[model samples]
Target chain A: MNKSERLFQLVLLLRSRRTAITAEAIAEAMGVSVRTVYRDVQALVLSGVPVEGEPGVGYMIRPANHLPPLVFTPDELQALLVGNRMVQAFTDQDLAKGARSAELKIRSILTEHLKQHAEQQPYRIPILESDDGLREVHGKLRRACEQRHKVRAIYLDEKQEKSERTIWPLGMIGWTGKWTLLAWCELRHAYRNFRFDRFEALDLLEENFRTTSDISIAHYLQSVIGMRDPG
Target chain B: MNKSERLFQLVLLLRSRRTAITAEAIAEAMGVSVRTVYRDVQALVLSGVPVEGEPGVGYMIRPANHLPPLVFTPDELQALLVGNRMVQAFTDQDLAKGARSAELKIRSILTEHLKQHAEQQPYRIPILESDDGLREVHGKLRRACEQRHKVRAIYLDEKQEKSERTIWPLGMIGWTGKWTLLAWCELRHAYRNFRFDRFEALDLLEENFRTTSDISIAHYLQSVIGMRDPG
Candidate 1:
């Protein structure tokens, strides 16, 4: 086995054990030399896997180390890769960036022809779906949602007329090909959703939605669930 | 090594070569016994991995297989897992189902303690963000976009005023929390986006956009890119 694969195997062995497992046991179990076991354990500790105990003594993974090193079968990885490509094909800037970074990280683990395959993927995210101001608008709404701030905007209606409005920014949602802002529209005196492309102008206010009333993202979520039909 | 890992390593070795590789060579390459390699190969072929050739003869993977069986490293799996959790937390029914299925498939390959970790995940996707009507609405838009159909709707604007409109449906885009439809509005004679929540009613027409006009999704995409700041 390669060193990376061996190191991964070491991690699995250590994580599987509750009490301290001796280096000799690990070496025997992994079919590697004792010195190699010692060296690999040191590397795991140095890499910060929360493996406790020292060389020649024993190694035990702490229980609080919730996110142990992960591994995905080929099909699982393929699904993720396919999902990322789908996102890049039809989603916003932030998610698109996340997908690219995810792809890069996945590629790093691949080797030889598989690595080459990862580099030269069969599917291509078409150079389609762009809205000049949508990315910027997403940034604005994202910040507003994060900060619990209110926003004011000049919105155009179906009549091709503009209206001034104040809204409590909730969060942004992306459909298959467009972005929409979910918010509490103060002008309409209710929660409303506005298309990202429809916002003629937007700005975040100094006032936060927290001080205004009991309205919140949690409440909004519950409201949606309640809207389901019983029939 | 576990059967799955060993099988994956076997696939990797087989994929690295264009010619048929012997079982003894595969055993030596993966640092496992020849019998173990034979058993793993049987498992792989049984699982429909498309690995070909007999034990005594040699093994080889055909080149025509576009997406060679995928295997995700620890970090790649984690990112995908995190993403799936995020979807269940915030998105609609269709995407939510995709994320759930993705999570299940990823968990299927995990072993021992890691499988337990996958079950009792650290992150809990709180039951927040709901819209019972959204899944149905999303289904409609998805079909509309796929079929390239024209639709008519009674839309309520910010003023709560209703307008009858005929539209050429292009696609749907989701923001952080909602959905929007990108369409060519016949009334205003321009590209328009309608919030799913504000649609008073909708109907799929006898008209298909395929034979209608030359306005392609490519054209709509370019219009957005050209909307960038001129100054």
Candidate 2:
């Protein structure tokens, strides 16, 4: 790592531990010599990081000296924890994984009080329903939307008429409980919102399309607003 | 707080500190007697919390015995910090405030190691531009949609003709860089997506609307799929 990164790591190392950490331990963790650790500590102290050291004991950062930016009020912490749970429960598996990982990271960083506060928070977004089929489709469409891939799907319309259409996937929008894929349809030659459950099969194509101003989501929404009709 | 809450708080109090805390300090922080603090610590030890108590030094929770749930990988921590910054940069002020507060909470809890990781994540989402008028309008529409309120809006159509419409706000949809109000337009007697910039005036009426099956976002999305045109 760079000098700046090493210095930052040193600070975080000190912050993570509650007791004084010895220069030998710091050197071991940071992959440097005790002399280097001492030099870095000196550099940090010189730069107003308020790192305290004892000759025989070790080093510690005095509380409230630096890093108020990381501090959160109780309610904020509660909200974050709850929000993570909600995301995990509500979104696709990839997002759920991200939320879970995010929550774990958040949990690891919290002080004991905040950790307890999070654990005891009353809110819960229990996984009430889940369909593996829908999750697979959602994940596929989400990836397509992000990567701007075209999708060919056998869709069942309102009247149960089956048709295969290739669409340039723009976005996966969640409306209440349902998910809709907003796309520029090749058959309709218009922007259409395809319902997830109505698709018998979805084939993500390798052919990619450039996001021109005409086919952009903004342009499509403008057409929806009757600002200009692309249909 | 209840007994369970007190027990949890006592555990957290012990966890937050690097050094052993005296019973007097615990009592003062917990708003309990030193005797009660001692009793709680004893209760915690019996409950398998691995609390270490010294007569003169006071008490501390042994490291790694609890709180694995809160720990985060370096990459995960980076994602969260970046995500929060992105939310603050991309969303409206109210959501930005929430994101900021959430970041603070996450920061406050992070061990120095993770804090350093977050700081050195080598990614940024700079606020390139902001429009206060757009933000205000977005905020207003968001609230109306959330509360299912009737909104009276003077809108400029494609022909530049102004028309007053009382609409039931269903959702505020963001497409690319633009935002649209998805509503049940009273004038059109159909679902209409109104672009934010074209709204000449918007009044969030005190009159709220019930989310009937016909007017719900899910139902509207179903219509967008050509399942049934609610128009």
Candidate 3:
């Protein structure tokens, strides 16, 4: 490794340990001579990088300087990219956008060389397929859910009966290629789930609602499916 | 800023834009003379930090150099410290430990001066009152969750009836003052929500289960509360 790289690694090792690291210990970890470690420590110290403790007593990194920029190994980058891609593919609309934004921010932090490799990296995450119409409706529903806006829709039941309803969207779920919206339905005077594909027309009303506490749409579903007690 | 710092900032600016930056542009950005910008650029190039293009054509960071260490600004560190502290406070056993581990890892990466400041920094995130028991259950539950082992617990229902149960813990929730676990109950043969405060005699079973897909427990909770339907 180059001098800069070695220094960076030394800093990383020192920070990992709670106790002070001796030069001999640092030498062993970096596979360098004790003399080289001493020289490197001196260089770091001279360069205004913090090196705590004397040569024999070991060293501890004093946290007062700016953090080094985030550096990711190739595999790490791949993991993040894949995870973000998955989020964009499967998440609700507002969350999907957030995921995309995060990916962009991460790219901005990468060094020039790594950034190029990242761009050339052909990592792809498989996304579950959903109907185009359903995807569009799910996107709008997600926005309404986030904004706590009221929505009006013509929902078709499992029995194929149509009903007009207004709801304060609380959350949404994607299951087995279908999208489900969990909302506080005004018509039912209760929380209800409506299938996106079964909805003929969905509209975001001007009316907004207060945000509720964090609750699981899955638990509601399990209860609705009789897997758990509704109460 | 020092010449090195200015050079670093200039490189960052060029990389962010994905375009060549002229010495004139660098001088303007750093409020320095063009001569100083030229000298700084030369120094960076001499140090083997890649800068592409001739002087007349402007300079661009070559996308091939290894990134410097991960650095965080003050505001960024504060944000991370706060977010991680919250996660440590409210999350399940495994996640809280992970948060601690992450904090340790972050500390290791800081420059020496920053390390001192970090040690002296009196910024402690206050734990919320409701999730106090979260600290107690965090370690054990986290390990069990990570291992995917069966967990035995004395659970209390809304009616205050106590029942012994074994569950496959899938996720956790921290809301207001309550810590809830989303788990696949072997007893019920379905997913259920159990409050951490209500759990007694918690034990981890030896046998482990296969890892499930990544499902957000929050979404699951919404469904449980009649906010959404599972179908």
Candidate 4:
């Protein structure tokens, strides 16, 4: 390896770990003699890279305030594009707008070639339905989830039975052609999943709820993993 | 920046562009004298990095077979996790499985800290319904889209009128709580969108279809951007 390349790689290796790397380790990584490692490190220090070396301890790089520009491979860019397209198509307007904004910001920082690559992306998202009649409710529930707030609603069951319920909104789950709001039902004194579209009246309550380890989305998903129709 | 950092930055600048960078341009970017740039370029070549140079012309690095490891910030990782979660929740079983496999593979290559961050991803996708009753059809159409194959389907319209149609499956779109297949209908000799769930019977034809620029997902999306209920 060339000295310039080795120097670049040395910075990367140091940046990868929090602990100081030993000189022996550096020598091994650089495929050089111990004496050469010493000389190269001296050269690096003279050039003004902030590498700290202690006599018998080791070497470490102090964290820099500014980071280098982030670069992504073509495949990574493709993944980001496709993922954002899915989010824009499958979620409410708020989240969809966030997705679009994020895409725009990411593109702004990309190189010209990558910017064109992103524009020529083959995947496209088309809104097939004019209205799903649940964007407002989805947004409200999403906010409730984000804020750890309670919600009050009049919901319908599978049997078409209507009832008023107060719940702690945990997370929103999208099944095929359906939105299910996973929450902790205060009435049931246990976790429950309610069909989002089945709400007759919905209101975001002012009261915030404290989440225990047992009441998170992860816990709820774990509880329902092997069950049939958790909702 | 120190000389080592400047040298590293020089390599990055060269890599970002396809055209050879002039010494004057390199000096401008590095805030150094043209003589210093020349000395540095000579040092880089001597150190064995493949930088090709021509006097009074420009310099460029040949494409390297091996690339540095891809690194992502915490926000990028979070975006990936959330996007994969949405895909897992809303798509067919095959796609859901693909999302899971992707998450696993990504985590495997990530740094230990990043792997931990990925595992602690708060977003969750819980399947509320045991069956959407369309996973099989979704998989079929997705494969058809991937292979550029024609599909023969007995479809039901809004009025319950049943008819057979031959379509070149261009792409699959997931709207809120619905999946729509965008295709070119051979019967109509025009682009069309079909409700994925509206298929009474579906079959993938052995024949592959050629996609023209005018009949692509981009064209279909452009044609329906302002239309309501395109499906």
Backbone collision tally, model 1: 21
Best by lDDT: 4
TM-score against truth, every candidate:
0.41, 0.42, 0.36, 0.55
List each candidate's DockQ score.
Answer: 0.05, 0.07, 0.04, 0.15
Two-chain complex of model 3, DockQ on C-alpha atoms against the true structure = 0.04
Docking class of 4: incorrect
> Candidate 1 overall Cα lDDT vs. reference?
0.60
Residue-wise C-alpha lDDT for candidate 2, range B85-154, written one tens digit per residue: 5444434567567767776665665667667756443232344355667767767886786567799999
Best by DockQ: 4
- Tens digit per residue, CA lDDT, model 3, B1-231: 644445546656766766677778878988999888777766555433456568467887665335433565543443344344445544443444434444554566655565554443222233345555655675567567656778988888889899998888765443333446778887987788787667867899998865444333434545554343211
Question: In model 1, which regions exceed 4 Å deviation?
Answer: A1-69, A85-95, A116-122, A128-130, A211-214, A224-231, B1-231
* TM-score computed on alpha carbons, candidate 3: 0.36
Candidate 3 lDDT, tens digit per residue, A1-231? Answer: 556556655656666555687888778756799999988887667656677886467888776532333344443444455444434454434445555564565576565666775654322233335434555776788678656778988888999998998887876543323456777778877778777778888899998876444333444446554343111
Q: After superposition, how far is residue B147 of candidate 2 from its true place, in Å?
A: 23
Where does the lowest 10-residue lDDT sum fall in candidate 3 chain A? A119-128
State how far residue A19 of model 3 sits from its true place (Å). Answer: 17
What is the per-candidate TM-score for chain B? 0.59, 0.62, 0.52, 0.61
Angstrom error at residue B194, model 3 = 0.7
Give DockQ: model 1: 0.05
What's model 4's lDDT at A51? 82
lDDT per residue for candidate 1 within A1-231, as digits (tens), equals 556556655555565444577888788766799999877766766655566876566787775432222334343344456566545444346655666776775565443545543433222234244543566676677668767788989999778799999998775554434556767889998778788778899989998876233464445545764532100
Total backbone collisions for each predicted model: 21, 14, 44, 1
